[model samples]
Target: MATRATARPRSIDFNAAELMVKTIKGLTMDAVQKANSGHPGMPMGCADLATVLWTEFLVHDPSDPQWFDRDRFVLSAGHGSMLLYSLLHLTGYDLPMSELQNFRQWGSKTAGHPEYGHTPGVDVTTGPLGSGFAAGVGMALAERFLAARYNKPKHRIIDHMTFGVVSDGDLMEGIAAEAASLAGHLGLGKLIYLYDDNHISIDGATDISFGEDVAKRFEAYGWHVQRIDGHDHPSIREAIASARDDERRPSLICCRTTIAKGSPNKANTSASHGAPLGADEVAATKEAMGWPADPFHVPEDLRYALGEQMPEHAQNREDWDARLIAYREAHPELAAELALLIAGELPSQTFAGFDALLEGFEVGGAIASRKASHKILSKLAANHPTLLGGSADLAGSNGVLLPDTPGQSAAHPEGRNLHFGVREHGMAGVCNGMALHGGVRPFDATFLVFSDFMRGAVRLAALMNLPVVHVLTHDSFWLGEDGPTHQPIEHAMSLRLIPNLYVIRPGDAHETLGAWRLAMERKHGPTALLLTRQNLPTLAESRAEDVARGAYVLLDPAGEGDLDGIFIATGSELALAREAALRLAEQGERIRVVSMPCWEAFAEQDAAYRESVLPPSVGRERHLAVEAGSTLGWERYADHVHGIDHFGASAPAEVLAEKFGFTVEGVIERWAQIR
Candidate 1:
């Protein structure tokens, strides 16, 4: 203990960070050269910068990649994967050099680029140049929200920065610029970006296509910018240190460096950007860097020498754990909640609070499903420690604010509201990233029409099995004044196409809570909660917990009277379905009306459960499905689907609903056609 307290800074030459860069770069180059593939250039070029950031600057413990306080590192230039792989291997993570040797191989951890959740150290799945940067902004925003909530007088648990190493291609991307602009406006002081100004993209030198001043562009976004010699370890270190000194805006360290730093033949060439340097170039690179000729020869002395200089990350984690343990004893309840949430467990009171919410909604008068979604989400957000989320510049309209007490900001992790601004794409990606982070469950809201912009990220969420709840409001053409551009005619069907995604369009307010409950209960994959812009009646049959089972019979009128056909629907169309059911019942025809909120959730139900809800004996002849938008999947329920196939007309929602054949009269007409 005394030696730990006062000793020769633990047996390393440089810091652990520098060693990480070296090991990664060395192994990266060897693997690339061995396979006669891959671009070793970036790993070689930015090794030192990565070392400083990962070891000294990045507040991470490899053993706990999911640690909330850890800094997030996104290799936005994911093509330069060797850079990330090497770092993960050296940081005492589960990844080792043997795994690095399998780089770019089938089923290997070291893929072409950093893939989210696929690799332990990876934060977001990045292959697209600029999207990762936007994702980073989201991580920083989460940090801000958490910090605002948890960082009390002395227990600062959520304080962490988001530092990413982006290549020239990332900076040149318009999406990256868009994200940076919003990040600047939000005044995210904890976000720091390292711009690897190697000036080489696949086509050739950046001068061929991109020649603008990047620092000026970032400055235009209101970011504090710094230009530094990337290879100068001390200089880069100082720049990073100085950046955190600012407390208002995000900072960017634009580092000017060689693409392939040590590869003698290709060091500064565009050829070094993507393709692997050949045997001769690699050999020449090794010799030029004064490295020995032996293959995979990370000199024993060099290993010890490098190891001596690095920080002891394991020790750091131990200390942090000790501090957290102390925090636990001092603030038992908060600590328990923190521990549970950090362990990806919800608070004990979570389900109970949800129960209370649904009970209250049942007592309250009927309102729009969006209103119920708000009451459900905000109440649970305020009560459940793990429930956390916000909207994309639509918090006011979406009804997603955490009902934080008057004049009281969302000041704790238990608080659920988030303000994601207008960056829908970034908001979705961040929501996915937060789900990937695995402590607090997160959801983001935007108009369903903009789901087009968020579709890619929603797909990634499925790919990663991240359970991000997408609260898509204004689910159909009823989003009046915004016009066709804001109306989502095909968005629901389009989103439904993504495999493993649960798109739940609840019929009424109580069912809305049920959709939310299902979304939270689910751990396997993502759930998109599609809500209506128009007001929805709180149906007498709607029960939150029962509907949480996915699909349930709302009104089985055939048992009450006569038997004929079944009317099926979701969202606002449920009312039309009930009307249709009542009309058939009055006509002495038996009818069963069902509200199927989540297609995927219903699909997940057992065969017996399925048959029980949508019986095999039911009238396929007179079956009717009524919805306001594209009825792509409605064929499963009804032979005739009354939905908007084309863009909606320029008129009020009720008229548009009539035009789209969503009326009970239209439902009757369609039922008669199928009959």
Candidate 2:
């Protein structure tokens, strides 16, 4: 929340609003009918609210979906995706009628859920119950942060609003509660959510499971609350207008809408919530609403009216472009920085000077990998304006603080360090928002074990191919004193299972920095950096460049003879693997110690490179995978795996290591007889 500045009220003509609503409903009904599988109730119910927001309130240029200053509208109740698709089509986005006809079909952009990059106007991929609700908070925070950093007395280049239509299910989710609390605490005035208070869910009436007073709940979270008749255009406009006046809190307008606003039979029932309306019901509903019988048909006059609205939104973008040009002439350096940030580029020096930095970063030291990542962040934040993130209230423990910046809060909104409280699930969603917002590179940190709480958001990030970094520390049984409750036994292997998600368990300080570098550079998807809680000795042969290859030979067999076995490991276990290999060498066994830091990254390597690391001749039973985690996924890489498949005990690091058979001697003994 920055200073309160009342946004001028803008209204769509009543006739146009009514037509738009009718068109939206018609499209939603027909799309669901055509798809034979999708939700239509929400789209029909919230049509009026969405119509007002899009035509009157949302500051977007459909032609230029990536306009930096455009307002974002997220459908948090994403099962009602037809609502978004209909709106996108009506608003002149690249979504054509043909795509609408092929709704939910394979190879079509109009998927069951609104996917971020797949759809032209979708701000973020949001299908899970409260994901969009939480992510909207992140988008608002990003806007406030950029506005504070870039906006001057008269040039408000970064000012924008984040709007979302949340469903009953979204409000019921704990993630939304956590995010809403944070948004209110941070005073995110630009964040406004219109809660579609239609009292039906998959089961039945929400009263069956959800009976809490949602307006009061939001008010308790420090939000500006308003309740309105959802179908009443005047109330919808008035509530949104009132919401814009309050800049000290996020706003939630609870609109009491019917499940299917004007349906003849299924209007207020659960029947219309998910399944498509039959042809007879659709026709009857259309006749009742005074809509045409033809599927996907919108009135010509309504289409023309909607077309006219696009120029108003496009003009704002054109004006912003002109102002950007003038601002560049007046302040060249700031303009260039802004351009680089929006393009997701770092400063020229940081981008090109990484080789030199890595060479210096290869200094050997016995330090926790978390501290090494902290060191990398310190250097990156010093030069990269786009670097921004925070831990889940674990800055001291997880080491995610930027040394020079103040914490982001209600008062100091310009600070780069975000304080995400203790909400790991909420933090992941917010990080996704910051990444989706473009210009800010956001990372979230928490202990590796708590990643289970945040996995839903992490999976969505991977699905959308967002470049969010998750700094997970206290990686394994090495986390010790916190005991079994805090240790991560299967986090590395489990996280590696996520498609397109890069899971890197770096060996030491240098490899830790390499993981950070990889996370920063990989823009196509999210990255999880698994670091150590205990201090790890730096290897003499640790090469920063070798990390990019995912797994590299840390120590080769002493003799030129055939390799007897390969000891593959990651994180703290790599050190033990090396020691075990050395001990085996004394007994005439030639074992190769390979540091496999990132399984996902290594899998992407060419067959030649992969074969070189794990040669086929000395394969299968000869390969021993050593790590203090579940042995579930190691079968892909090793024949015999030495890993903890049971819960750990409460003890010191050394005791836990020996108890779990993770020590060098333990590994050597196990390797000697395993085959």
Candidate 3:
């Protein structure tokens, strides 16, 4: 398709930026008019600034769309989707006008909002007000992590910016405020946002709900702010340039413009906010802009002129490819590794190295699931250059980020890890964006108790089937002294309710490693690793590979397995189940102890596997379970469960375990009652 747009402007001065913007506005309007549907107000309003960025500043190759170093552009106010769609089509991205014709229709490439993995050149999904803004933060954060880790003096391998075109609605969302504050605090120098201040929202002017000093608020959050008249192409270009030149702080460029610039009666009117301008309004707008081409049509001369420029973009990509090829000569291994990583493929050595490391931990140690998770995560991070993660203000406590890979402090385009500020919800949402961005495996960490704050994004992760692992620690009330607020009495059971999620609460070190292995292998859904805060002895019989089986018979009566009693347990209480089995053995009660670590994984197994573990028709009259959290999900395993159904209180670890009934004695006592 021709990259050119519109016939000659036939104006006194031929400004490329103005012409580009006007061309996009004209095209978007025509598409809407043709389709009889779409949101066109922002496209008409902010086209100038958007064009200035794309033509002058944006580093992208339409010919090679997946270029790693390409600048990311997000349409945060997805209601103005025609702005992005028309740009993608006119700027020579893979999207064609036919896709625009199919806009908002089922099975069409162009959805109401840009969906990740569905559209080419669309970086992240954006629709729910602040979600796109938060995703922009993630894109900028991803760029930072990659830049910090891989960029060298000679090779600027990861020095790209994340830019977003946002509207008043995006600013109104609380999540946007949360993300903006965090982004500023981290000094994300390369995040340049262009705010389209048309002053119009769906409910009319933004004065009704949004009246905060955004400039002052962002400045307080530690960002560089610049304000420009949105219609002044030169001024907009200058602000974009300044933001690009900045190296110490992130930037926000506020561009002031009219809502609908040329619809005559509808210009700056609330009527233009959603619906397309009427036939008379469209003709009137076209006449005022001096556009003579028929609706849904462009002159061949302009098409040819723009077609010549396609080579300019193609050459940029071709040159980058040539540089990469030359770089491969001197650095074959690095080049090959990067090639695989960019393609979302793991290095062959990753699986091999992981297995070698697994051998050492097979025997396992008496370590808490949390501590064991760290050991395994640290080892994996050591070998996998692509592994990156951080906690939601809980790094030291959660053991998610190891010491070697420093926490991502600056928003460098290539940093390996990110330190998400106290916004747990924003952190989870951003990690979702990173994983969906296609070039990274992003992870987030937080205390298991704070998981309530992140449940929305966690559900989104499961819904989208993104492999964003949540490293959840302090999994139960065994996290003594912190009391009820810090304890996760119901979180584990709560997460189990997610359909495709894998909720793994490993018993010991070996099992922790096993959980990570399964998590990586099950790439279709989110995985929550519920690691314990307190240490528990890595039991003698428990193994990592066995834990990967979801649930297994750890200890059972040697003969006549038609059990009189059976004990089920997870985490530290596995030993209690063993103890209960031993006590039952003395009474000549045939007993089986089942270690159920991952409910989601066990549920995925066939009926035979689940039946073998839980026994479809349990003949045992005595059945009991020992765990340190709410007895919500475990009730199916046994009618009588010895667990903390209520909140915990401040106390010593041993004292709390005894008080909460998470003990061998408790399981034995509960077992006797079941009998």
Question: Which model scores highest in lDDT?
Answer: 2
**Residues 523-584, model 3: lDDT tens digits:** 67889998988777767677678766788888868776577766778877887678767876
Give the Cα lDDT of each candidate.
0.75, 0.88, 0.76
Show model 1 residue runs off by greater than 4 Å: 1-23, 33-37, 152-158, 290-297, 306-311, 351-366, 385-388, 405-417, 436-439, 559-565, 617-623, 635-639
Candidate 1 whole-model C-alpha lDDT, 0 to 1: 0.75
Candidate 3 regions exceeding 4 Å error are 1-40, 260-306, 348-365, 405-417, 433-440, 463-465, 497-500, 521-525, 547-549, 564-568, 606-608, 615-627, 630-646, 653-660, 668-675
Q: Candidate 3: global Cα-lDDT?
A: 0.76
Q: What is candidate 2's lDDT per residue for 64-93, written digit by digit as tens?
A: 999998998899999999999999998899
TM for every model, in the order presented, reads 0.89, 0.97, 0.85
User: lDDT, candidate 3, residue 534?
Assistant: 78
Query: How do all the candidates rank in terms of lDDT, highest first?
Result: 2, 3, 1
Worst 10 residues of 1 by lDDT: 1-10
Candidate with best TM-score:
2
User: Candidate 1 on 491-518: residue-level lDDT in tens?
Assistant: 8888889998989998877888888888
How high is the lDDT of residue 485 in model 2? Answer: 92
- Evaluated at residue 154, the lDDT of candidate 1 is 62
